[model samples]
Target: MIYLVEHFYSIQGEGRYIGTPSLFFRFGACNLKCEGFACSEVAPDGTVVVGCDTVYAVNKEHFSSQWGKITKARELLNILELYELPEKSVDIVLTGGEPLLYAQDEIFVEFLQVLHQRGHRICFETNATIAVNFFKYEIYKECIFALSVKLSNSNEPYKKRVRGEVINSIATNAKDAYFKFSVDAESINLGLEDEIFDITSHAPSADVFCMPVGGDKKTVEANTPMLVEFCKAKGYNFSDRLHIRIWDANKGV
Candidate 1:
């Protein structure tokens, strides 16, 4: 079963393809709880939930009512129809909580195969911890991957966050892939360069893009300067959290 949290049509807000028109399919469930990033929200029962910006999608116990259990590829295709998106013009981004967690699921694979058959460019926004067998799921070979791997700033242990073999597998098998790290002033001061370098060593050929760590406009603004300079010094691409800047933490773009 595919547990979908939300779906939206919006411009790509960060990474290499920022500002591109895209349809997002945000799934629930994740391998890591990045509490260190510190974005929080209140649950329906008034519980103060905390984690990454998309905590609603991550804390399933708090937000399970919001997740849609999808059992068929046709349901997703029907959702796509509502948008009436131009034929193959908009990109398809499968995000999370950790979308790749369903890589081997029959329905998830069927959805990807259907989209691939229709000539859409599919991109998975993943943490790079879950590795897929591209040999078995050949359709994934033609997809793009935006590897948003968690860093030390996420409060996840190094071993849990950094899986060298998995990173290499995605980078080598995907048609196109890149690394995107979320950084804040504190993390940068704590020697983030070395951390990023260590992670990138696993995929030397993939390009790196870094964005400031923030779930709101003010936070993003406060961290952007340091991140920009850090990127300048390290020759990494600087990406902005454009959605937050434009909508100020509004959900669903």
Candidate 2:
């Protein structure tokens, strides 16, 4: 039973695959609320802290929004068909509220396999806290995993967030996996350099992307220079949250 938060067709607005046309499937429920990452005071609070980003889908209390009902795999496929991009090859981005929370399920795996068989490139935007034994599946070879590891500045407890062992295991085990970290100026100054070193030590060969934590143009602009400098000093790539810049943290983008 997968509770879909929302689905839409848009350009992939972040990471190495930025600006590519893609279909987005946002699933409901995240293990991490990240209250400290809130973008504005208008943001709602509860199990899910609502901010500029993903305001509509995440509820005020639990971050669980009213997104219709549980959808079967076949029905989801049908829904996807409606927004197919025929001119160019499309990438399917499975995002959250944490999609991996349900990725371990039989139906979800089957759906991924079906998508793979049809020649779709699947990208997973994951929190990196959950250990997905994706290597056990054939489809795993076809999928590109984006491990967006959360840092200490996210206001999440160490135990509740950064699972270095799990991240290391995934980095060592998974094929085509990359590590992306979300950081702010304060975090960069405090210990982000050390954290980045630790992550790269585990996945030395993987390309690392350091993205600024922002939900609006102002925040992105304010933080990008600092992040850019940090990345330059450490020989790392800097990623901008393009969706937030263009859409102002609008949901279903």
Candidate 3:
């Protein structure tokens, strides 16, 4: 079953492919709840809530009520036709609560194949915790992986977020993969430069990208210069959330 939370057309906001106009398919559900005090806020009831920007997709308890479940690739193709994608090659940004969570589902894989056959560039924005076997799932080899591996700042326990085998598999199999990390001052304070080595020790091929971890422009601005300097010093790349910078973190852009 392929559960979709929302789909839209927008410019690629970050990573190596920044600023490219693209079609976005946001899948529903994820295996991790990467909470962090840095991104948390006190609710009206005084509960501190750790929310991801797309919590709608990740919080499965509400997903059935909100997500659109599609059983066939034809239905998806019809929907993409509504968007009237360009005649030339444009990227299909497959995002999620973790789109690869559906990687093993044949129907979902067929959806990907159809998009690929149509000449759309498939870019997956993943947490990179799940590994793909390229021999069995050849379609994955054609997609670019925008790997945003969760870090200590996300408040997920080390064992849950970092998997050496998963990292090795993506490094060894995916057509091309880039390691992007969500950053905050706390992450730098914790010596994240050293932590990157620990996580990518197995698959060191892709360059690392660090984007300020914020949902709004102001928060991102506050952290940008430091992150840029950090990136320069560490020889990692820097990516800004251009959508947030331009549109103030509005959904369905």
lDDT of each: 0.92, 0.75, 0.83
Q: Which residue pairs collide, candidate 2?
A: 47-61
User: Can you write out model 2's per-residue Cα lDDT over 132-244, one digit (the tens) per residue?
Assistant: 77567656657787888777776778777777777776666665778888778878789888877765676678899888888777877888888999999998888888777
Per-residue error (Å), model 3, residue 190: 1.2
RMSD of 3: 2.5
Cα lDDT tens digits, model 3, 1-253, are: 7888888888999999999998898999888877672454344445555667676677666445668888887877777778766788789998988998888988888888888887888999999888787889899999899888888888888898898888788877888888988898667878798888888786787788999988778888987988898888888889999989999768788
Name the lDDT of candidate 3.
0.83
Query: C-alpha displacement of 124 in model 3, angstroms?
Result: 0.6
- Residues 56-117 of candidate 1: C-alpha lDDT, one tens digit per residue: 88998988888999988888888888886876568899998999899999889999999888
Off by over 4 Å in 3: 37-49
What is candidate 1's local distance difference test score?
Answer: 0.92
- For model 2 the local lDDT of residue 109 reads 87
Error of 1 at 60 (Å): 0.9
What's the lDDT for residue 200 in model 2? 64
Candidate 1: segments with Cα more than 4 A from true spot: none
Best by lDDT: 1
* TM-score for all models, in order of appearance: 0.98, 0.88, 0.93
Root-mean-square deviation per candidate: 0.8, 2.7, 2.5
